[model samples]
Target: MFLSEPKTLTTSRGTFSYREGGSGAPVVMIHGWPESSYCWEHLGRHLKQGLRVIAPDLRGLGDSERTEGQEHYRKQELAKDVISMLDELGIEKFQLVGHDWGGIVAQEVALAIPDQIRKMVIMNIALINNLKGNMEVIEKVRSGSGKAYWYQHFQQAPGLAEAMIPGAEETWLRFFLQGWSNDIPEDSIAEYVRMYRIPGTPGAGANYYRAFADDAKRWGTLSDHVWKIPSLYIYGNKDRVIIPEYLNHIEDCFEEIRVEEVDAGHFLQEEKPEEVAGHMNGFFETD
Candidate 1:
């Protein structure tokens, strides 16, 4: 039986899918790339005991309707989707939590509409401010067997999408799920794969990275925004995709920043859900 109700929302652009539960101050949870709102199933169950949780699958992922065009993959454009979702739901202000690419969207959302966000908890990603000078990490991951992590570079090339369509979902899912969790039930993988198979999703996922350069140029020097609200940053000590060191400068960016390193990997929420949830709840309880 499901712990929450999965709802489909009609936004200005398309139909977005989300799972919501609990009943308190609103807390919006955004899932990261190659994953869906289901990523927060476990964490949201814990959070729901005290707070209302809305976990949404961004466009092209999970039950959300898939769309064509590279413009949909841009962070700025993606952030607008969240804004529209909030407006559609009649939520004026709420707390935010996001992981991976979803974290990037959360940052942009905070920057674009600070009035709508009361506080934020980010897991497994550095602030857009930290994206500055991260090309070295990009090149490093792209250099060796890690080339798969940089698949977006290839997807950006003409005809690569057609080349990747076959078995792309399974291959990518297996690549990221390694050691993410020993307890991930069989159904979880099935749920992820179901969404992964959605038409045009593979291209949309890769396009997120393909458009990174453009996003960097458009939101240059994040120091101006510097996250003024209360914030918490949680990272997996073993996260291979996004190095933990890049977050070194985050303290200087947010005035009331709290940072914690957990003993897990890139999929921290899955690898160490209890720890991450505990830290998140404690932080949210604070003023």
Candidate 2:
């Protein structure tokens, strides 16, 4: 149950920051938008004994270098960051786990380096291509009833997300604590806010959405690539941002896939860590 403070490593793209902890087989955890590596703190500590967990703040979030260019926010760009982080640590192979935007990054990483990953665990996310094709999410967005959550697009608007959400870090910290999980520990919330409050955090965080929009628009209608790696799909049945139907055709894109549902929301790991970890151990133990 230990975490290395954020450290910087130079990559082909730019200087990236990440945290490492635990021991044994490498397991890199990438967090979604508006979150730092802190999102995996609980699960990382629990899995530390047999798994070396490395959590990195994506390009614009946490302490990672956030430079100009929406290109830096592309999903593939984040995947490159993961590869570069592994290379910096001299790790040739590992497992991957990601949530939200991090889940999107995990998908691309598994595709970009299929041979390097042993297994991939995606939480509360469908494939980017599948998500694009999901009519439910589109209908929700079109209905305008999603304005409260889909306000992500508004957050991407220049200077608005940061401005509207006063004490942006604390605002989001409290938001997720209350919105995503039912039993968020007090100390964890403190740590979560610490990273979220860092400088340049807002724009870098919001860049995730900007890249998501571009990727969805550009790659729309393109069939997704199938990867041979063993994969696990865990989604919260109550997740509002992503409908469960998005995961329906996901098996068509992966050679080996298993799906599990939990009685939680978008932040399943936080809400049900023990259940999530139990399933993860059971699935990863499979031959």
Candidate 3:
């Protein structure tokens, strides 16, 4: 039986809804913005054949409780939610995988408890410091030279996003789902729309962007921090949201890292689950 059923855990911060399946070593999978643990269903099914898989809806997203303040959505606090969830489950160690915004949270979780994470895989995101200060990256985003992350700027506009997004949530979300991938299943898109339409979800999603500056500051302060565990970064060559060029900055952040480029877009796992799962399996099996 694939353990994709929803399960909830009450942590000190709030209740977190997650899915658990398989029966071997644990693998915690985290989803990014505009998505939930449901995004990992395909990948989880693939991994659950040989490893335990846990996919959680981050606080205020999916089925998780909507946190009280925007501060609760900060990357550090989000990372804490994952840590606390594991502690409550009595899981002391596990492998980690995160995509997009989840990739950022995974970095914080690994950094917070390096000893507990056996290995990590970050997909479709550039984990680097001084994001705001990186003029080159800023120029790429601002100039629309390669990939323009216009949503990052728009979401940071406080009350504006909440005002404009709710009524047209499906339209707004389809823009990302279609724009970022070569192909995504219609059912997956519908699922995301249904979940985001839940009350308080739009504001909760926007809070992630609202806390960008603080996230940048935290990464900036940890600029010299080097990742001790083995890490793998998978990038989609056609990812319009996060271009392949961003990988240029990731080399210094990890002590030992390997990069692989796939022929997909931002949502590579969905676009190419077998390939993504193959890479993950090979990477995780290594010493």
Worst lDDT run of 10 residues, candidate 2, spans 128-137
Consecutive 10-residue window with the lowest summed lDDT within model 3: 128-137
Candidate 1, residues 1-287, lDDT tens digits: the string is 22365688998877888888777788888888778888877765555255777788888787887777777879888889888998999988789998998998998889888887888988887578755435555556557678434555666775586566657666667766765435554566778887778777777777777778788787666645567889998988877667755675677678789989888887788767778888888877422
Clashing pairs for model 3 are none
- Residue 269 lDDT (model 1): 81
Model 3 TM-score, 2 decimals: 0.93
Better of 1 and 3 by lDDT: 3
List model 2 lDDT by residue over 51-82, tens digit each: 77789888877788866667788888888888
* lDDT of each residue in 1-287, candidate 3, tens digit only: 45576789998888989988777788889999889887876665565255888888998787898865688888989999999999998888799999999998998899889999998999987675524325456666667654366687787787777788887989999999888896777767887898888888888898998888887777777766778889999888997767655776677777889988899989988888778888887877432
Local distance difference test values of all predictions, in order: 0.76, 0.76, 0.82
Query: If both were scored by TM-score, which would come out higher, candidate 2 or candidate 3?
Result: 3
Q: Report residue 277 deviation for candidate 2 (angstroms).
A: 0.9
Q: What is the lDDT of residue 218 in candidate 1?
A: 71
How does each model score on TM-score? 0.90, 0.89, 0.93
Ranking by lDDT: 3, 1, 2
Backbone clashes in model 3: 0
Clashes of each: 0, 0, 0
